[model samples]
Target: MTTEERDQLRRALSVYVEGAPTAPEWQDWNFQRAVPDRQHRFVTGPVVALVAAASLVLVVLGGITLLLRGNIPEVVGEPVTTMTVAPSVTATTEMSLPTGPVNPAAYADVPSFQGTVRYFQHDPALGSPGWQATVSVRFAEPMRFMYTVVEERPGDDDFLFLGGAGTTFIGDGTQIWLDEADDLPPLQTQQPGFFRHLFYDSESPSPAWNEICGASPERIGVETIAGRHTSHIACSTTLEDYELWIDEESGVVLKMRGPLFVGDLHPQVDRDGGFEFTEFAIAGVSIPEVKIPQVEIAGFFPPFHMVQEIDFGGGSVDTVEYWYRDESTWRESIIASSAPSAVGSFQLVADGQVGQCILEEDLCSVVPLEGDRLLFGLQLPSPTSRVPLEFVGDHCDQLAEETILGRAAFHFACDGVRFEIRGTWVALTDPTVGRSDYWYDKGTGLAVKYTGEGWSWDTQLLELEPVFDDAIFVHQEVEEQASEPWPDTYVAADGIVPAWSGPLLDGTTLDLDDFRTLPGSEPGSGGSFVVVYDWFPTCGPICLDGITDFQKLYDKYGTTDWSVTGGPNIEFVSVVDDDVSVAQRTNERLGITVPTVACFADEIDPAKGHNGLCTPDSPWSFWSIGVPSWTVIDTDGFLVYGVTGRDYDFAELDSLLADISGLTES
Candidate 1:
């Protein structure tokens, strides 16, 4: 098909899967046809092995015979050690109830309400396969619980399942097992673990928890649910501010709120706001086990445009919700918005830290500035197209507000923790198109809330805590090396390619077999100085600048003993489109025509992919402007010089070029 027709087809598909795939045209078949890699990584990992072991322990305790079964006492009566890195919390030695009347009736029938759990998650980031939301947990008799994650968002034609049960811990008289299956990598698993250790522990020193879920031994007022009264306890933590309803008589937890992504992503806008359970059942039934696909989040959205719908074409689309500590709620409106640029540099921060920031976006650091104003770097998106957006700051403010489901919200004020500032985000399209609310408390600045159509997660401000030893709140840019200008210190050789091979950029080509080095035995090696110029056809300014620089370098150093060559522009042409071999041939035909420096300009082999031996430090540094380029060979055919773009040193080039020429420094 013609490129124009192909472009049109791609655009049509992009628009078709914007909402619930209620249409037959976009079915499972189409979903399978779309997503990049269909394989699921969670079901086949070392982590899953732990889950299986947990199940085996439970079975052995009950005297069940299985190949993987363990000793009954070791599985049940024996202590199951749990190693955790938790925050320090100071507590009184005595366990006293809160200053309130005991509501005995509130704790009834809590133990009987235990059963399997099932749920789904939706994300606004349409690119992710929806596996984070939908969750199902099956509690073993007294407390063993096995949970499975089935299906993800973006609606895949087929569902991936993760098979496993949760760990067991003894609480009061009943054994308890909480399903924690969201440990899949590429999903920010570490962040969740950080939360678990900080708040859940009563020994945690962080006072945030007490503010949300009132401390134990202290009785809180009672609340009625489903014709039964229950004791309500509220607490908050830096990671997750939560509340728990306990059956006063059974001490069983009937309902809970605030076990979600916290920190900047979930600022405590309203600690008073929380989630309420609508229903409860105590039954064991097998829900379909689903393996969740591992998703890697590359970058963040620009500070504009509220996302409306994320089209996960098939069943891959799963759970979607907003996790924010806000009292104003969310509303819908017809707002024009612009999409952020997609071309971005990919870098890995440490092992788990992965970031992809635009080259032009402003990045500020925490280092003190000499002046009142702070200087920062900007990472602008690539020269690609951006989504159009009309900024509307106050459009449908009242109508667009809605309460997020299943999210726990909290608010806080501490001595060291303070908010720097908060502001209304206005998209570029219109000064008043969309409004974004940010919260900052103490050492960690603004706690930002992130939510897309069907996906949502809160980035804890403290999770990515800044280390001032180097710099904080500053731009993290990878510095590139710079090499000397080319050609002035380099030279191109003619008859570089075999005459029988074909035509070169400079037109004429002759057999290089006749050439000899100073030692006489090495062909084209004795007394010959060779340099390789690197250039890319698609690298616009950078490539052009490199070739021009190399040409000039050769002019100043050109001599009977010096020769240079560079691969035809075809090597630099984007391989995404044309065939490599065809492009290579075409590049040789046009390499010399575009630009180059040669000893015998008419005898150079343009058909040869490269002008000469790819030299590293012969003036042109490929590492700086392009990938890796420039390899210089001496009279003995030994590589004597090499350099990569941006990182090349001019002094080093001078030394290498002199060495290749067999000339001593003046």
Candidate 2:
């Protein structure tokens, strides 16, 4: 190979093979902390967020969004006053279930209130210091609220994000409307109301709702909270116990204490933390007009082209190429397969227009950017810490300036910040909210460095000149190979199989009923495992990598360890559809001693690209969904798991292997 070819090969080898961040380090990918996905492209590389392809946006929150969750419709408006919940507070202490049901929905349409509240979350047993905050809050009719954080106290954790503190956020259901302020965070102008997540079905909601709630509050009594006559109620659930002090007249909850969880996403966890009103009263809230923070990015922005290198700590690395044409236009491309041409790729880029598509299988989704919600779609991330600092509600602590990669960069850090993805709610933030140290290039305001737990990456400036080509800012069309994956044909087994047969390379016809089973499994599910590797060397470097891996795996055959305490059962098979002769030749060439199977194009079935293991009349198709795919089957002809990617999901495969190992342990 020429030097150029060798360089390309080396880059493709190092760049595209490992996409996810390593475990216990950058393992909690920041995807969950962002909005849900529109059309997520399965990445085959590292935590490098690339948007050159139209699939998913790797938001600063951690990972990509694969699923979406809609907000629960609020039962507000009209101020329904049919609430007749008059409970006699005869019992002064803890008691059993109350005869009078204390329904929270009954108070849902009650008078709105405004007051100062205090809340906290802590669990010494959870092995980390917790958080506490004090904020003044006000809500007027449907979707008008002014939430101002008075204080944020995070204990013992440098990465502790005091969410939305120090800034009075005014929202009329969506977008930040904070008044004009100098040097404040940018207007997280899109989907700003995501902080108010509704996780329960309203009609019969969980008693844990922070709104006019529902759910059975186990016990009822009377107490005064915030100087209001209240019915102090307590609840008991399988997880923990909680209490609430509701207004006797209005049905509004005056105070509440319980385990903190919003439809399952709970952070600073393992303990119940709650908030209560120090003072509250019925009042009409006046919505204020707040201005988006103006970040100083004139000379600092348009930092041009740069490449970010992410070290996965396991001798593997990936790079994120940035093409920042200007402030409003930029692209993040993580060359999953190969770059410059960007095949087998996943990236983020969009035209200045609103949108184009939202199909999950499509390579691109131009999610509508209504206003200035650039970061919402994994657009260009600003060099200013204001945006992230606002998300975490931290007062930007300007750290000492640092030199990174021979460039002077502004240094700052946030405990954590949840990036917003509008209308997509697969999951919430908190899974990967680690202390993140950020460094911005002083001259360009480009994020030069981002370091978190156990892992770190650097953005080295390649060029600082303006990208003159307007075509570079234009989004690329979806390619055939880079689109969504092939349909998953793997199915669960029912512990039974037909007497189907296929030709093995040893000139033997192996029937489903002919294999031996593991010791503890059912008698005749065609017993021994047929670990099938679905690839041949003709499939390029991907297939070559698979063949090499298959060789290592095939080595386990006939060994004491392979038998797992000497049961003498599991089998390994390599499937090649080229031809029986081709299979033999490839196997010999690759030194693949494992028994090979020839699944040549069957005349009975229409020709397809990959006609794997020709059990033509069998229920288990066992076909290669994608070249370099692999599947596991029991002695029975049933699919245990199937991985259809350029690279195997080794962690998932390891888990399946362990499960089988446990089954054969006896």
Candidate 3:
């Protein structure tokens, strides 16, 4: 057959496979049957090759259809089309009483919309490299909504291709599906007013808007945006200034610009750094048909596995593998590439039970999954209809309508914890405290971007796909395994305190046993007590509070002569799990008068007595889950009382002190 004929045949075959009722008439025209005007040529050469290729494609497609049978649902209903409704701009027009408080209720209506938003950030102080992300969003009520994200950064080429296929919230926005098999809870519980503003150009005037615009917005005259005439308005908050251009007829925010602040209890905006929308477009969108795939155990028998490599900085890397078994049961295995012997594994069953096994220690423990324990799974928060306005306290103030990437967001400032962002990573100081600056999309109530002291996260939507896999919700029996009890050494209150000798910050080298003897007296004289306080310099504000409390107690009773009672004289010593310089710094910062000992040296070599006081092998080291643990050692070197964490029983401490002082209770 001629090349032209071959091309024609290919097109005909494609059409037939795509649901054509009948094959093309060319199928009956065979070259093998002698043509009336041409010499007979048996079907050979290119024709045979072309026929074979076409046959293979058909076979493959047929096999795929068979495999997906019953799994892929047929489209049952006609395509649903939703129109984008533009809000009336009269309420926002200059003639509409611009001198009064803007009524929030006037902008409460929200319309559905579908569009793309892009974000870009540049900070020369953080280096010449910058960050960028693209998000695509689709919204349809009574069904499901989707958002996909693709991110990129200079010098990080791999992230350019690493896209978040985004996530889908199914059913009345209660259930969420992520990746291919992971299930998560909804991001929001109710529809937020901001969604109406971001997606539909409709306004939902919130308290934040009233607080910011109520003061009196300066009208900057008229401006044109995307061919639409808009009224420009300038506003300000306590932390940042903003400029917004609103469509005069639709009341939709067409363009916005302002400084970016971290979303935390304390608003921290970078005077030199800000974000703006580069492009925004609204249009009607058709809801695509989506089918939740059925999950069968037989499809993933011998276990389906996935591996991920994590870089922990400082040249340390770890490999994590997820292995799925049965239907809802899976195992996570972690191996330290630098230390092969350091291996850990966890098994999660459908019944919300999780088991952790330490291979090197030959130990395993099983526990129920709840609260923060869910972090072990591949679940994440979903964007919901309600912007978490509760996080904004009375101290918060509305800033401006800011365009981040392409999405119009309502920017607000409030008291929040401060954080520092170096590139994409964020580290918050005083992690327990602080509020964040929120850039909420008015249309979706989705927080497209949030910033706080040291950190920020921007969600850029990507393509949406069905993520439901019922097997992920299946429950399985939790296999019970005998676990070894945790080791108890200095941690035991009744155990004998281990012997240790070290130099104090006051230039005194002494053994713990020395405290048992009175100066210039016999070795077996009166008993004495050693009060050891263990703490970390990097602990949160609560830890500092603990230090202050300890200092107050010491000042009131440190020198008291408890020797009159049967109890020994008290000697206070603070052991810090850091270098001497850090320890000294903490003592000075807290105004602690007590002597402090460093656990490590500047070299930080544990073998050379660095961190020796806090090392697990040290007898003086008391195991604590957190900072500010207290240990009381009697004159005989026995641990009398050991407490871990905060909220100590001060009554007990007072009672012990009274007994030692030989004083009777009132």
Residue-pair clashes, model 2: 33
lDDT of 2 by residue, 503-597 (tens): 78788776656565645777543356667776644334567777677667556442234455433356677766455555665676667787776
Quote the lDDT for 392 in model 2. Answer: 28
TM-score, per-candidate, Cα-based: 0.22, 0.42, 0.34
Worst ten-residue run, lDDT, model 1? 41-50
Off by over 4 Å in 1: 1-502, 510-527, 562-628, 664-666
User: Model 3 lDDT vs. the true structure?
Assistant: 0.42
Candidate 2 vs candidate 3: the lDDT winner is: 2
Name the lDDT of candidate 2: 0.45
lDDT of 3 by residue, 187-295 (tens): 2112232123232133332213334554467766564444445556666553234555565443445544433321111111122222222233355445444343332
Ranked candidates (TM-score, high to low): 2, 3, 1
Query: Lowest lDDT 10-mer window, candidate 3?
Result: 61-70
| Candidate closest to the true structure, highest TM-score | 2
Tens-place lDDT digits, model 1, residues 1-666 = 112222322221111111221211211111111112222111100000112222211111011111210111112232222222223223322234445543332222223332222221122222332332222223322222332322223223222222222211222122222222222111101111111111222232222333345444334445543233456565433223345555455443444433232221111111222222233344333222222222211122222212222222222121111111111111111111111111121211221222223221211112322111111111111100111111121222212232232223222212211111001111122232233332222222222333323332243222222222322112366322112222112222221221111133344442222222544364543344455554433223443445555544454454333333321111111111112232343345334223232212222354642434222322222222223245454443334454444444545665655544445555
